[model samples]
Target chain A: MNDDDRTAMKKRVQRLVYMAAGGRISEADLGRYDTDLRQIGLDSLGYLNLLEGLERTFGVAIDLDHEEDHSFLHTIDNIVRYLVAQGGEAV
Target chain B: MNGDPTRGPIQDALTDCLGRHRGRRAVVGSEALSYDELGGRIHAAAGWLRGVWLEGGAGGRAPRHVGFCLGNRPEYVILYFAVLYAGDLPLLLDANFNTGEIESIRSDCGLDALVIEPAKAARLEAPGKGDQVPFADDVVLLPLSRPGAPPFEPRPATQVCRFTSGTTGRPKCLEFSGHAVVSAARNWVLGTGMTGEDRTLCLAALSNGLAFNTSLLSSFLAGGELHFLKGAPLTRPVARRIAESGITRLVAFPTLYRNFVAPGGPDRSAMAGLKHAISAGAPLWPDVREEFRARYGLDISDYYGIAETGPCTFEREADHHSGLGRPLPGAEIRIAPGPEDPDGPEETGEVLVRTASMASGYLNHPGLFEQRLDADGFYHSGDRGRLVDGRLHLVGRTQDHINVAGRKIDPTEIVAVVSALDGVADAVAFPDEDLNREALVHLVVVAASPELTRAAVAAACRSRLASYKVPGRISFVAEIPRTGIGKPRIAVLREQLNASAGA
Candidate 1:
């Protein structure tokens, strides 16, 4: 993916995170891209919901093999980088 | 008398099931594993476990309490049998629990070893050396060592253990005997009229009671095809599953039903194969129940149970009576005067239950379980219900446990954790209905300083409690309303919380 596509994809991911946190988290919160999602309001379940949203938005199978596998996929920056590496592109 | 149905070790049942029921489907979801295949896998895993435990190493002693940090996979079932087959207690841990919750549980039960997924184990950073072993194609096992944890011996006859909310502090692990575990599954199958032809679609995680007793072993023992849903339980996905697998029995919690009969409900013909659907844990709204019946031509039967005591009541379609239904066989339910009565309580008594499937006691705290039980053998279920003309109707619970999205959140437990924070001067928690009419945990606290904002409280709770247990809404209150006995007035406290939210 090009730099513009990657930036768009990251924006979409942050949008999904905002949706999952019920608007308690906003774009301003994503200024610190490495902010722990758990501390804000996107909890473990919220993270799962965010994954489901990403899978739908990106048309990619970002789901883990098992629910426990999501243990390593928590902060916003980690997930964005992982998605980009996994070939997810923004339309 | 070999399949006597009520008495036997679950481990022995798997042994008896080996290779005998070949060609009969055991699991039918991600991949079809017949009894022959499942039985072989169980034996193989057990053999590997025994080899590892018996091998020479520091602290060669075996672990009595072992935790299963597994997910909703077929290998989870295999490891469960393998753990029990080796005469060890398998503690089912939800993969969704956080690092802090996991550490608290390890300390509570004095767990010697935990078989967790590699990713989760890494996240836990659990003490002791970690070794990776193959569990299934995609899942690997990480055996966690609690090197310096105290050694614990379970109560006599303890067979299976799972954690439930405690009155204070971390959650307590409840232990069940071999006979109790087997009887729970057996009675469910018998009482529900499950047959080999029945293809059940399990919708909940295996760690929960609804899925464990009502769907998992119960389906296997009855020679039924156990199917796991591939996708979410929303209307479209669930309808597709029903059409594809011809799921005869649907065992899911109530929210799924609410979603099914909501505005954009599933097509009527798609649910044609569903013979009977059951909901456990919290009541099903009458409108949802009626709409499901109207649209699908089936009643959403409700099952009432307590985590401490298993399978207290099953709603049978008898006499057109519709309250929590009748108690299951081998269950003794007592209704006595509540120690502290609820305002406008429908039932004038509290429910006490004793069943063959009841847990032996809490593994960590001895005599803690008995404190809930009176002079009689019955455990005082925190619920308030009434029995009239042989039907039990539940009004409410005296405890402040909140049920949000199928998880039990203890208000007292949160209060203890939040109050211990430096800037917090007393904290109170209660459940309130969100805009969607779902339960949400709300916290009202007297902060030592105004600088302790909502974000600050959220950060503290996120560090300490499980994700689900964190308060959805936090507010600052002047003081907690209390009665003459110094107990927080719940009605007034709820009003304060509601007012703060409104503001």
Candidate 2:
């Protein structure tokens, strides 16, 4: 994906995470970048729902096997990488 | 020869009452079946079963294990008693268990024959290579609508298998003799203050030990009536029946109680006949218990028992702080010192019991059974508890203790505190090891509101518990994960968490 598309995807993923989590994510922290939901005080269940929401929002099927490796899901940079590799398979 | 010495303790109690008070009421669904009529049905079922068993066998041999997967109905009551009277063992399989779970349990327990509802029977999967049964046709379809027969004398030395809840792993078979039934009946009567006048609402399945002891045997032996609900997700009609039938007591889990005690819900005010309510399967959350008690004007009795030993300790007329109440008669409890404290009975330890109704061992797993059964035959219940002020206090499961970071946190303790929080309906703490640092991840069901924040929940936990005991992270949910019986299914919650992470 191009830079503009990647930026939009990242913003959408973060929004989806907040929405699934009942908007518990602070508004001030919305635009700011975070590696993973865990760093933003989201629990495992939170991180999971974040992934689910992102998948549903982006219409992509996440590769959960690789997602288990923290390198894939720990930070926003890693997660966007994982999503790119997912190649936009619909949920 | 009337050889069934293991006959249920309540059999003679009912029979003797039947002889003097034949006009007394019993139950067949909503209908008030007189004692004589119920006795007649038991007799008839016994006679029909005897004939069927003899026909199926070469030399009058009764089937060792007959599987029953019928819903809660009058027929199940008849069949269960008939199986006991016929001196044949009946395997009570879960009606709601998935096809795979059902087949796995049936095969693992080595069911010789099974009786299932026609619809459920059709849903059975075809046998695989490892499957011993040649065909689905190998299972005999017992006529559920068959009439009662003459009560026949049972042959002796009979045993039946009831599967454990499989909370830890694949369900294990716990064997119970006729004597266990008898002992359990006597204990139920003494423990619950059951009399001939008390009418019981049979909410729990007859298969589980709690239902069998508290409802079936307790009612039969006490000369009280047994009212069984027809289907699951008990509807308004069922609730109306419970009130209309004048059910004096209901022995159920928390989930069912939540349904009955919902906001402006049932005609609970009409249920004036209800004298007491009993809860088991899992620890009754204080809110649910208080709600039930206040609505019904009855003290909620919290019972603690396992398939290994039937009806060990119960909260009979107990205050909220008594833990699980004292041990029932013919039951002895001891707190086995944990590795943390191997000396005297401190605050908490593994709760073990020696009971007249204790199972001999787990079926086919002698070593597993032996590990639980100690030198003097005390069953080593993996549950941790404390002996406090001559009363037993259950802490939590030994296996369920999650090592969050470096500190061990009992999910039960977290649950108790979290459940009491405002807008927090329920909570389950599960182990989450991320990057080799194990911590507890809490799934919390909160009331739908913008104010229900994870930070608020964290603050509540901080105020209620120690620093190390607080959850590492919290996720808001609409409802907590639950098992078929309404207990907080911790494993299911963990699975849902994992699936969430994967997505």
Ten consecutive residues with minimal summed lDDT in candidate 2 chain B?
B145-154
RMSD of 2: 16.0
Query: What is the C-alpha lDDT profile of model 1 across B210-310, one tens digit per residue?
Result: 78888767788888888876544555666778888888889887767876776555778999989878888666788888888889988888878777777
**How high is the lDDT of residue B123 in model 1?**
66
Q: Model 1's DockQ?
A: 0.16
lDDT score of model 1?
0.73
Model 1 chain B lowest lDDT segment of ten: B55-64
**Please, what are the lDDT tens digits per residue for candidate 2 over residues B95-130?**
544454554555555544556655456656535311
TM-score attained by model 2:
0.62
Q: Which candidate leads the pack in DockQ?
A: 1
Residue-level error in angstroms, candidate 1, position B189: 0.8
DockQ of each: 0.16, 0.02
TM-score of each: 0.84, 0.62
